[model samples]
Target: MGSEQLFGSIPPNWEYKTLGKACAEGGGDIQTGPFGSQLHASDYVPVGIPSIMPQNIGDNRIIEDGIARVSLEDAQRLSRYRVRVGDIVYSRRGDVEKRALVRNHEDGWLCGTGCLRVRVGEKNVDSRYASYYLGHPNVREWIVRHAHGATMPNLNTSILAACPFLVPPLPEQRAIAHILGTLDDKIELNRKQNETLEAMARALFKAWFVDFEPVRAVGAQFIAPDIAPDSMDTRNPGAINRAPTHWPPHILDLFPDRLVDSELGEIPEGWEVVALGELVEAVKGRSYKSEELVESETALVTLKSFARGGGYRSDGLKPFAGTYKAEQVVHPGEVVIACTDVTQAAEVIGRPAIVRSSTRYRRLVASLDTLIVRPKDFRITKAFLYFLGGTEAFVSHTYAHTTGTTVLHLGRDAVPSFTFAKPPAQLVQKFDALAAPVLERIQATEQESETLAQLRDTLLPKLISGELRIKDAEAFLKGRGL
Candidate 1:
């Protein structure tokens, strides 16, 4: 489809005009602000004010979390750098094309040195339209081509002011923005809903299993003293002698009232914390030196093969030999943890996965970067261990213990010293059972999100290139009822 056909059937009367011609004469201004040298960690206070940086600027939106804060004193000193509503902020260096439109809530936001804030003239253009125009594929390509600096690319004020654009009528610009924004809104809602579901599942797991409240109640009921005012024998004398109601006092008293502190953190009663080495063997897989890695019917598991919540994805897999055997394999239910790359801390670091299927590797090797855990005792369930690894406690301790100057690595020797609480075998089994469904749902949601994201990505280029028209998009969306 042609641009006109896709944008609209009966085209809105729009003009092709340069951005410079559309803006107020001498109206556009691009300026840089103070360096980080002027900013101090002490000057930052949480919940005070939002500080905008290049990192905050995404493709067309801003990320607010972990945003730096400036004190009232610093804010007054950097008053000239304060961003107003409707202003467009661009990354001056590093990634020249990255930009974000200042929203209503960003009126009082302050920016850093690496960012260039653009305030448009109010003569002939709408800021919203200009933001969309700048974000268009053709406009971004122009910006990238003109960006300067050999080592780190950048867009200067002159380059930005001179950038070309298709100045569609203000109304049409608004309509396009509205359409894209609606999709973005829906995506955000899905993300938030998924987060809530994940949080609820985690909370339930903590309450029933990690906290041992359910098992504790059962233990109290089963192991009550034979002669006491509130003994189970007296209160429920009829059921006291039953097999199901009988439990050893030692088992009931396995867990204590309060948890003890270890190097890792506070753990549940009766649970013993040990180093990662104590639980499993750590080894790096062999490097496939051949340029062309062959694909076979047998699956070859790599670091990228294992997704965060989704089990294993074979779409990106390479070929392997038929001779590959089980000895050089990762079996179902084995725990795999990423040991290197602390920079991705809390991403998948220290996260464990129970191999749901068998995978083959070259040279009888597992991935060098992943540390596989083989549970020494049945007392600690693999599911329980996976959840434990997913926790902040595990990540923080693992990060602290990791050693390396260039790339942080989890030394095999250090794994055995890592400590954690050891809950009883029966309680662990109960926790494993409780966490199974929650984890399964998480995996399912992740897979669904992946599919949706792939659909969006595939449609993006076609939609932007005029290869696919709005009618086509409408028909596609209608077909899917999306």
Candidate 2:
């Protein structure tokens, strides 16, 4: 059924028309990428014009990482399918509802084989509004329902042209777009800030634990076994030959003066190698039936909650059944370790995500396929444990012991036994004091973004359908001080 058929009543003073009519007055046309004969796999290059494929369409932006790019000449040969900065690209097949706006970075790139592009005139029809309209939940579902393909869903230009689109006046369109855009801009800002904060935390972790920079500052040096020192420093007790003999008292106080050999090479004298189990243990999650779950604020944190790096995925949250034990609850700042992963050849089976606070009223708990890793004692901070799970040794161990032919699984017992070097208590405390805030700031910003996203979702449909006027939406936002 068409969007018009899906709903009987239309908002007052608003008219429902096909997308073809609105796009007909635009400066840019709707089209799909070059077919098989026009492009080939061999044309792709490591560094050149990027080919925007189905995978590049993130929620509302272009995701180019790991995407294939082609040489400048190849891109020119297929220039007819080229996209501009304001074009809204969609997946032509597999997932017809997915869309992404081509920003400055994606300008002049080829819309790859599995995608479609729609561009509109900024004067007659606001391009941002057009893009936002197509991305709206109702429009996406309408497209999905109207799309053709028995085994695999597909979309063509004809079906797209007939999409039912609700349009307000050009000025009203811009106002509505502005209202939604403001919310998205704030969310994007928070997301970027969180990324920077997490990166800084990881860099600090590497400097303190892996590189031993603080210990090296206090006259301790590691001479590779094959190389000899230039001269002997007889005055300094801890310094090896040719090492710096003098150091400030404050720098000296931060690290151990002595070094000793261990399985992980020479660590500080008092530090000892301990099993992961001794410091932290995995508390397995509960299983929930499909029918028991409901869409609400409370979510069940599953393996999907794990982000690419060390934080939780905002979209990975799932609704809960409102029944769970206290032990199953995963609060903010706690770490969630993935116990299962893709059963393919490679192994990253045990990825970690530090739980984040979503809303003031919402609660999260671990579900099946996740293991809530709780520190045995307060000695190791949650932030420290999160990064520790991501280290080289820990990852290697996970890959070495993983079982199952297709659905690879990491044994819960192995988590506690995984061995790693434990830094001195004072150093750990200092590291926590430094790195914990970075992670917390990320959590705070992420929570704020979630609230902004909710507001956007609420205002978008009302604004688009003409149920809420521009002045009213503006007043609503103003009242909330958004």
Candidate 3:
């Protein structure tokens, strides 16, 4: 059914208006971003104002990962292209329906190349409401249907300006935005918190296993194995000593005191250089025909499932209609590594990602391009191994072993042969004990965010089309403790 049919009977006080009419009444305009002549490739610098390209535009948010930047001088010259808070930026070419609302922090960033900016007058229409309305399936369909170009769908100023818009009273618009924004705010908070939690876990792994900070403190002889270095007072002339204090004495006692020579380097005494195979085994996934990919409850975790640096993304899940071995099936919290990479930078290949639960799929299987890493011994936990896989040494090792031109492939023995300085069993367990809860918290927070996102998405179309009243939605949220 068309959007016109989706919004059948208009509610009382609701006004049907085109985007152009709404903008004209509010003194707003839909303008294309800076042209290629205005901003050249050479203008991009390592540090300066962020230039939000089409890729940066995500679902109602700007994805800052690998975003382009420009010099201050260039940004100043293209000041008119600068986005303001409450502005909506859309991709001008492919995926033209998707847009990102500019937040306070991104106010001055440029509406970069291959992009279009929709500035709505705050006094006439709530930009937040406009963003959510645009995200509605019906409205998105309209944009996609109207976008020109057979090869690549493109959105021009006139195309967007002439797009139909459903407008509510200014007060009603704000209320609807608030309800949806509340859920979005919580989701964003969880995302940020997860980033911090992962960073903390990675930092601890680097300190104990990679840097061997605890062993160094022991080697310095500044404090006894049974005592924390912080217990010593620098104020006392005789007690002045240099040692790390991050680890508690009980935890610190787990490390060996002296450095020993190894093929890899000088590692802590008693810590052995061990192959990854000693701790875990890598199981390759199933290869399916294109015809076997379909809309099903079972999803195939493909190369796209892994984020650029490292982490799982549910959006990469593809519904599958193929058969797979029991070993190919993966669950939430399981670790998986990409076996192939198509990126020029080799960003995905050899990188590890923890699989996340999917609301849409009941079962998940690893694709041929991925390998499920499972613990085969008690020496290492999944948490420890996941972090270990993220180490620079591990990534470089896999990268070096990859063979191919455009599509890099990791050798079958690449994972097993990769070596690392293995810490003691007790230390590994202790690290897991500390790190597991942090990861669990992150996962739980992510799951909650996913649920909130679903709720927000479900409420969006109904609220925007006047099929569901604001008061009723508020009541529903209140009942759910949202």
Candidate 4:
């Protein structure tokens, strides 16, 4: 397999072939299986046979999560349409670029109308190899160019059958699949680990803040007089004092005083109510001229870049033509609020980030969509403030005040006017100090996830194409012990 002797310089041993030639006798079959509307919402059971759809197909992978399910009776009726293990499913309707390699034998079930399953005949070519080839940049470009319909792009059976492929021998195909699979495996592992870490952090946040368990314990201890000081130990718990309410001999007395009001609701005594604008600097992102944008390695912060999860995406980011001023910069730690869309209102919106680094495109600067809060005279810690802003109450207020039909706009004037009960500075600082490490870990994990995604994106095009051979990739990984 001399690399120089290959077709298009793709390795001599590898032969250039069309997908139609490698498939079963009849041309690649493209047919819609069953309609989704036939399955009623009431009939949707939690755990059952999964109904594969275009949405299930990701970047050379199948997403089982959020998959629709159907009854066994429906599955029997569509038995002939069932996909087998090793079948490569291509999306025919929406998001035509998505494809998946059915690695697990269990996924051999009926797929939705939007997807067509490709079953290779008894040939030396590897299914995984075919999946990667079809998902490659060159093949994808051809598909995109040839796809018909302006409203929705599609790849019919004819187009797919005629699509060319760079066919490597069975051994080589297996080797290539193995090499690429290793990298993907590592990526998936990291993603899962991060998910677990995130879940742990969320659970801790819930226990400490949302449930107010710690505060409740503190409050309980403060009000209970019948419980001995040793029995009220913070570390190991003792029997709780069971004094009658009218008897007035419980820990409630020691708890901090609180006030209930119609306007601001219930709050700790001595806490002040103030508008969000009073506490932080609220600013909108800049709008750059169309021509000013360029593709570069720079990280551009945009509203679309922010995901529902508290992180920024680099995908589809464009560079700024001119140098951005410091004012236009979004420092690592500043809180960013999404002010434009009220529908997505304040979910991940109004969230703050402790900026760890600098970014570009200052002109298309951070938007007023985000209300940046820098601590002022108040005792509220930045971390605590972020958590508060993320609360349902704050989001509801933002949603209520949002104006405009097409694009829901939460104006600057409206933001600053929204108020919340502010706890004493000392208490706020204490909570912030306790919560800082947790928040920092969340930020770090997010950054790590971004880096991993970037690495995968960088390797995808080269690996998918014959430009980088599997042997070379394996050598690279072995050398790095990755």
Q: Evaluated with TM-score, which candidate comes out highest?
A: 3
Estimate, for each residue in 1-482, the C-alpha lDDT of model 2 and write its tens digit: 23463344655655666776667766556788988788888888889998998867887788775677989988888889889888888898877898898888788998999898887755567778888888778888988987898777899888888888777677888888899998888888777666655655665566566766556655555322211122122222123323443433554577776667899788877778988888876788878888867886678887667654345776777888668888998888888887777664233367788887776337887888778999888678787898888887777787677788878788756677787778877767766776676676777778888888888988877777666788999999999887
Q: Which regions in candidate 4 have their CA more than 4 angstroms from the true location?
A: 1-7, 20-58, 61-94, 100-125, 150-152, 220-274, 296-299, 308-310, 322-326, 339-378, 394-421, 445-465
- Global local distance difference test of model 4: 0.59
Error of 4 at 137 (Å): 2.3
Higher-scoring candidate on lDDT, 1 or 4: 4
My TM-score estimates for the predictions, one after another, are 0.66, 0.83, 0.90, 0.71
Better of 2 and 3 by TM-score: 3
Q: Write the per-residue lDDT of candidate 1 for residues 266-345, one digit (tens) a residue.
A: 56555676555565555444345444355555444455554443234433244555443344466655667666553532
**CA-RMSD of model 4:** 7.7
Worst 10 residues of 3 by lDDT: 231-240
User: Which of 1 and 3 is ahead in lDDT?
Assistant: 3
What is the Cα-based lDDT of residue 65 in candidate 3?
Answer: 86
Give the range where candidate 4 is weakest over 10 consecutive residues by summed lDDT: 229-238
| Residue-pair clashes per candidate | 19, 1, 0, 30
* CA lDDT of every candidate: 0.58, 0.74, 0.86, 0.59
Off by over 4 Å in 2: 1-15, 34-46, 64-68, 92-95, 121-123, 148-153, 220-252, 257-261, 295-298, 322-325, 343-349, 360-362, 399-408, 411-414
Decoy 3 TM-score against native: 0.90
